[model samples]
Target: MPDLRLSRRRVLALSAVATLLPRSGLGQTSKVARIGLVQSTTGGSAALYGTEQKQAIELAFNEITKARTLGDIALQAFHADDGADRGQTVNIFQRLIRQDKVVAILGPTLSNSAFAADPLAQQAGIPVIASSNTAPNLTKIGDFIFRTSVPEDQVFPTVLAYGVRKHGVKRVALIYGIDDALTRSAHDVQKKAVDALGLESVGIETYQRGDVDFSAQLTKIKAQKPDAIILGALAEEGAAILRQARQLNLDPKTVFIGCNANISAKLFELAGPAADGILVGASWFAGYDTPRSKAFVEAYRKRYGTTPDIYAAQGYDAAYLIAEAIRRAGTATDSRAIRDKLAGITDFEGVLGRFGWSPERDATVTPKVLIGDGQAKVFAAAPAV
Candidate 1:
């Protein structure tokens, strides 16, 4: 955990250098390629998740910058704490664009922040890639807005389908936070998937963003005795739901399925034994047996002193994808050119698996399922449709 803070003078100096460098100087001159990272550092139960995400981004940057081949394209990163505030996110993005003049933008992990900063990036003609923001509306932002992480529209359907098909789940209860865009999107997708499968959504419960108590929601859900309860919220709400469900002694034989946010180690820490049997669906797992994945996991652990989560893996993959796009475009100077190159990516052997992008779906990689108790195992692969 090296100190991630950059001094004001250093940021200013770097900003000045980035603005002054000519387009032709990229990858040939001494000027470093600056990347602006905006992530939430306050409020949400997922704040620690954001911190872990930042650590992963820095880890990838550190590894890439240290490589001899990347010497010409020094990867410098600037971080902004959006605190899950949309207004703060917009303000920070404007600052990064107007003041820092970053070549690309990396995050603002939540969908709300991604929604806010994405348009700003498009307006400024810079490419913005999100690691974890999964709201369905995010993909519609513009060509400038891209997400390495799978959108909820893609993730939730697969999760629900798996629960219904593979696990033989008949009835499901969904608990979601109304204020969170990702959760709402997941709920909608799950609802559709459940209906399509001819399974009953016996229970549906809602909560506010900052609400810690899910007793009422859990009480309602527990009474339904559905075959499974799908948690469609961030880490904090998910943890609360588990804790309250446990406290109520409402352990339905029904399996507990969770969205991507439930993959966080903090969720297990917060929920303790209650989180043991929880099922998580995600695009990448650090524990995957692939050589590239193993190496990435080992390097990330060596650098950060903890196991890397999917968010970290996604960040690393996003950086690598950006670098590859730069390589294909033959220069890092033109953001639009780099974006065009990225849009054409196919069969990219990334840590997350082979990445292929299309206008209809940005991610072509199949997602994996894992249990929260111990090492994750792939439950199923999403068939290429």
Candidate 2:
């Protein structure tokens, strides 16, 4: 019952509809809803993904506002960059909640940043929808915190299971970032999945977030000669590892299982042909053959002149989710009301497909798996996970 009206496609052209609507001020009674958008738009490893997220969010807001999706409530966005740093993220959260007086907030891109920053939003009664952070226990921060990005635990297992069935993977090695909440949680889930699937553990290696040389880890993993390697690192680190592994002359048949972060196009750019065999667990993929997902992909390509990835898809859905929550709450200014309505959303047709909240307030959607294209084009769909 959490407002399904906005999910349906609009019949009227947005330009045509805009002409009939009144302005926000100057004798017009329409209200402007201020929302804060936080992400690592620059000065961080997540900058590429963050930049795309910002672009998609702005695109979604443009479309929503043009269509008058929230009726009289026109959205006013206040975007901030946290540089993917925890310190900057917390300060931005405080500033958005207290100074800007935003009813809701989205992002603070990395999971470590979210862990450090979301508590402040929770204390301030501001609802936050995470477009990118997918570490475990994210929503456990409070009722006020939610995420359009599904948790690592929910999707990684399915990815591994699919790998086992299709690739006949048995012995698996693991590598992950120890310093990041996202990578750490991804590691934990991948390990758990490995154990549950009764796969042999040949080696487990760890690295810091910014390390470039994975030669030592790859050498050790190569000696073990596992059927597959599970990666808990993001695209940048994962790319480095893949290139180094290829240089080390690891087995050609060895498969690579990557987390949600490795779905970025930057991975292929950095790793070159070394990225050919990766299978990534993700919340969304560009070529998904569903109505909502296809529409989103086509719209995004039309607007941005580039195909949308998982990050862009996440941002677009997050914007609409917030807009829908605002509409259902009936008061754009009430943070608590909006939070409640957002948590109550049981069915939302998003680019990620039929989106909903898990009991943990994390996103619940059928996860998609992506594979390399044997060329520059990567991330084609594998079966749904």
Report the error of model 1 at residue 343, Å. 2.0
In candidate 2, position 245 carries an lDDT of 88
Write model 2 residue lDDT over 1-385, tens digit each, in one string. Answer: 7322211212211322233234542134357677877877675469868877877887888778767778777776777777777887787777678877889988978989999989998999999999888888888899899988878888889889999998899999999999988899999999999999999999999999679999988999999999999999988898899888889999889999999888776777788888997998787777788898888888888977888778989989998999999999888799999999999998999888886898888888877777876485668877543
Give per-residue CA lDDT, model 1, range 107-148, as digits (tens).
Answer: 878887777678989888888878888777786888887777
What's the distance in Å from true for residue 219, model 2? 1.1
lDDT of 2 at 196: 98
Top candidate when judged by TM-score against the true structure: 2
Candidate 1 segments exceeding 4 Å error? 1-29, 374-385
Q: How many clashes show up per model?
A: 0, 0
**Candidate 2 residue spans exceeding 4 A from truth:** 1-29, 374-376, 383-385
Model 1's alpha-carbon lDDT is 0.74
Local distance difference test, per candidate?
0.74, 0.82
